[model samples]
Target: MRGSNSSLSSLSRRQPWKLINIADLPDAVLIEVVCRLSCSKLIFRCKCVCKRWLTLISDPYFVDHYLRHQSDKKRHIIRTLIYAREYVVRLRFHPWTNPTVVATYNDLMLCYGNLNRYCICNPCTMQWVALPRIPTYTVHRRSEVRVGFICDTPCYNYKEDEHEDQKGDVMQHNAAYRCKVVRIRPPEKGYYHFSFEWKVDIFSSETGEWRKAVVLSPRAITLNGLGFPHQGILYWLGREENGCSIIFGLDPFSDKPKCFFIALDEPLNDLRHFGVCGGCIRMCGLDMATRSLIVFYLKTEEDGKLCLSKRMVYSLDQNMYLDNESNVSLRPFDPNDEDVCYIYVYGECVRYKYNFRTRKWSTIVEEIPHQISYSFVHVQPWWPTPVPRLPQRACPAESN
Candidate 1:
């Protein structure tokens, strides 16, 4: 018996070393290898793998890493809508061969269309979640609804990861972290005596139910705008008591909403859009008489007063226009560091970069066939990383 055992051990030791294929590696080892790959390539290839690998790669941590790497490697592309006299069209930057309608926030892209009607897709993992229909309201015989996501208050415990060995508590805390959807709509035209009364309905993702309708304040109602949730608050561009446009920040954690006025001393003409830009809320207005684009930079003082510090004007001729009493022509790619201003010129759906140092602008990518859209969210590519995906495929079945 001892001689047989010795012979067996000798045979095992003599066996040639075996090579392990990447696909055969354990979950933890595979994840580490995946971290080294290009985000787009890794995502595209991983789909053909087994289900367990799919689930592991789809975790939020991997998604976050992939996004961070993508942003670090390239300028984030922004989606925009360009309105022509006859048609409203969609455009994207860094055109993809198979571009699908996607909902976009800061850096994250959700599938576009009705929240209840679309599929939520995570491009990085090619994973999707189907969601039920989102509620809506009608205005002027047409249902006008805007849907957005808001992070749940009392943020999930971040420290649990430090003590992963304590599994029970960590799992409990993670399960409690949740998010909700906020829907905004104006009341039907004839239903309310006041035309400005708007109803805000919130749907909790955790509970999957709509909350009671909450009437907005007079100022918030009149604006009839959607809020951009950032840093635990929902911010909207609103008109103040004096009728000047300003940014209002709403912290759902508190009972009363906090307001910040973007005090542009100059008169605003035909204000069209408001959004968060470069960590501050920004409003864009068009000077109709001159066909010039005006962007205002807002600041908050120690005394809590809001002030508009910088005014930039871009004329149709593609030149930068400084704020002067005299009519100014716009300049292309002119950047003002003091005002934290960066100007991106659009030509044939391609965005060119203009460095303040060179005082010159050049095309980043030439001859790209995709139409590109420019919006405030495009300015900061890192902001939309967590945007949720739609629930269903937006295109028709036959088309897919």
Candidate 2:
């Protein structure tokens, strides 16, 4: 028996550790595995695991990764509901039929609807909630609207001596996040009277109240399209006095709305859609003739100045914009996709995928349903609510 036991011990010592199957791994290991996958796949498979896994995958970092991956794939679609006349109009990817009207928000369809009401729907969960009634005071005269999240500022200091004690722990946590609503009210009375006064109001979900931010100056009156919020910043396309269009970025945490001028190679007349692409800002505009589409990259110069660099211009069919008198809506289908962007014409939507190497714009989707509006919503990653990291402790003065 001793001889046999000795032999078995020796065999065990010589054998390598058995490879761990994904099914047999611990929760942490499994989570790491899921994190490495693409966002869509991660979201699809995350629920298969237990509730704990669901919670972990919702982390903001995971959300960031998922959004980034989706953008990279050029698969992100903007949902808009248009409410006009008496019928509700919904626009999506399908070209044969009208896009489905899902929900509404801030007197606008969350998907695609008319002017009086809008819907707010969660696409992934296939759920939606109706927004409050559109205030009659400003519903008719307003030109543009937007929604965003707002959170209370986190305390920057908590401890002095424990700075290095929980560095890893702090890095893993997510800071507090909240949602806020923004509305851009313009002064344009049907007539040629151009009242440049514009006001921005913010609705905080946590406070359940609406507070007015600083009113934009008349000289800052070149805002064309709706505002888009990403990475805690709200962005909009604005035209300068010289008729050149640029993008303006506003930090919700700050008091004044600062301008981040996007430098384009050529001058554009009307700017429409602005979105997040590969962690950078992207702006789309219509050419002077309205038959072509122009894209600008929101980049920073060597001096760290933010500017818009002209990326490319895509021309559609000759008569595409011949009779269309309204402005064009150009948005990025996938926030992660840097090569392709989607444009909304009068009755149809087209996708413009750019190949930087070839310097060409390939039309992907020729005909899509014409919806009134579209907005990009984000799905946060599974993780615990993040606590703000305490500021680094000031080091004691070094002795001379």
Candidate 3:
């Protein structure tokens, strides 16, 4: 024992090699390692370590590569929604690099930090491109306004697995074309709070001018500022003052808009939401009485343009709901989240998830409810890559 201890002391005193730092790694090697990371929350926090690491992370090529992986992975960490209070916040952090997302279509978002300004950006890649302010306004009860933007992708087949016996089939949405932005404005003097008279102006990249719709739609109020693209067409579900539900559809090829209001088969009582899931229109109804969500897929037929077929009825877990005092509509939104979907952030934050294969439901994220459209900190939507394009950002943000 004495001899072994003496030998160990002599060897310890002999020598020790210098420690290696993560910063010493090559750019390619570091990038490969960092791209696998789930979200930028950690990256932004750790970027303060060294200038070389910062510079490498800022490279557009590396950023693009990472975002490509992010889109494929479908792991969204930042939950970007809207603020009901509409508080105008200043640049608290790096607004350009870590921008605030206002509205989202697919993975692309209408982002702006300060009010009255807007831009389109992919948060996953940290690639931001500025968009011109849409010069239009609508006068609703509070002069409320809504904006519309659409992203085009090449030949995205949304209904790849439709039943074979279906009589009619919706054509594949040709997304390869350039995207267009639309601004809708209701006349200030003539329109009532429930007026259907509205005008739409579209901005296309091919033609740099804003073009007006061929026909003004009576159901334009259904647009509601945001448009959902399904099978290459944009749709907005609306309900008028008299309580009649309407559907507004815009065909990209013809630039023609149409409105239809056929009676719904079922008498809907609770608040409902419409969204595009798997390239088809899906409606989710929040039933506060039983604390259950009724989901239906909208099908088109020769007789009736809008048809609702029951998809699934998901019950909100008592543990997730936690509050029995209020039967107020939770307003379930953003069905894109896979493990769970975000319901309204009212007095309490409520969220749930459904499995398509198993048709199972689970409570994933729940927190104290905040303002409207505001996403929580850890549970954020992974912004997807709309298409493959190099971003031209307003602030050549430090990804030098």
Candidate 4:
């Protein structure tokens, strides 16, 4: 019996019990398991588990595959985190500090501090990269300089056979969308003084450099606040010199900037806003006579021209809280679910939420405007699209 017991003890010592031998698992299965993790930081740490795991995690092919899968499954969720509030569950431990918004694309957010500092962060992982100084333009008053963050539009996720170029295309293509910061400045003397010309600057992670260009726009358009990007084009709410509110579409990949009529009737009012939904640009307007808010979906054909169609109309229940000039926008919950969106009604000292799914209306918190400088965290799964790196720096205010 002593001999038998000794043999058993030796066997147990030689191979202790493990929950499961991850190393023994098939490489494909192990990768799938790692891809299911909720937090990338955790996955990153898991890479140190073993050499095989490390090789799989570090491979560009695996990274691109994972990103494409996550993006395709639409497994992530986007929840706006108001930075001002304390005691957020789980995230309370991270140091959000005084986060000022600069730009947003997918789950990535670029922000700057009150000083001329900058950072690119993913709230989901609380992982951030501090970036070096932008090559062109310095922080200035809101009237002079404006900054926006955008990435190349994501491609449709589809399964393809493994090949060198296949991996390269997916990895290189996805890495391109890592994040690009755009800084626009009006020439101090002329453009800032209604010269209508603005300087465009871009910082690309691929090249890790900033390039500057000038848009010698003769037409006037609203150049205030953040701009929107879609299908490789960036959009902003602006008005023509004739006082007609128009939507200006800027192709970041090109120098051509054009303006399109936002409303059927000329809307010179400043209470208008726009958002991207269902791959279309939605614009807000007011029917001056009826005082009802009108929303239109502007669709662009392959030829690059835009056509507008009235999508929905919302009538105010209580005019006291709602005004003819209320800022209205529709934020789609997910690209996969196009039928649903959240209507954000701002201005008039009142804030409310309108649900398009059930056509229900309710007043949400009023401090949302203050919470504007926040980030969206969607824990849902997304298809793999490899991303790049950036860091935070001390700079002026950033946009989202």
How displaced is residue 190 in candidate 3, in Å?
5.0
- Cα-based TM-score, every candidate: 0.53, 0.51, 0.57, 0.68
Error of 3 at 89 (Å): 5.3
Answer with 3 or 4, whichever has the higher lDDT: 4
Tens-place lDDT per residue, model 1, 343-376, is 3333323344443233454545433223232222
Q: Mind sharing the TM-score for model 1?
A: 0.53
Task: Give the Å error, residue 307, model 3.
Answer: 5.3
Q: Over the stretch 19-137, how does candidate 2's per-residue lDDT look in tens digits?
A: 87666777557655675564444465666677666776665455544444444456534333223322322233222133333322222223323454433443334333333334566
Question: Ranking by TM-score, best first?
Answer: 4, 3, 1, 2
Give the distance in Å from residue 226's predicted Cα in candidate 1 to where it truly belongs.
5.6
**RMSD to true structure for each model, in Å:** 9.8, 11.8, 9.5, 7.0
Whole-model lDDT values for every prediction: 0.44, 0.47, 0.52, 0.56
Which 10 consecutive positions of candidate 1 have the poorest summed lDDT?
A: 82-91
- Among these predictions, the greatest lDDT belongs to 4
How close to the true structure is residue 396 of candidate 2, measured as C-alpha lDDT? 14
The local lDDT score (0 to 100) that residue 74 gets in candidate 4 is 67
User: What lDDT is reached at residue 63 by model 2?
Assistant: 53
Q: Write the per-residue lDDT of candidate 4 for residues 1-400, one digit (tens) a residue.
A: 9999999999999988778766789988988888788755677787778888889987766776677666656655533433324324433323555655556666665666434555666655455655666543455654355666777666333355476555433532344454567777765663324446667777666555567676755464446546666666666665555555666556665534443334344653333334556667766555545645567787888877667754677674554344434455433333444443344555654555555456566765545443343223332224323335433333223312
lDDT value, residue 303 of candidate 4: 71
For model 2, the superposed segments whose C-alpha errors exceed 4 Å read 1-175, 188-196, 205-208, 218-222, 230-232, 240-246, 256-270, 274-280, 288-293, 300-305, 309-336, 342-356, 361-367, 375-400
For model 3, how does the per-residue alpha-carbon lDDT over 350-390 read when each residue is reduced to its tens digit?
Answer: 45555544656565555424434333121243323433232
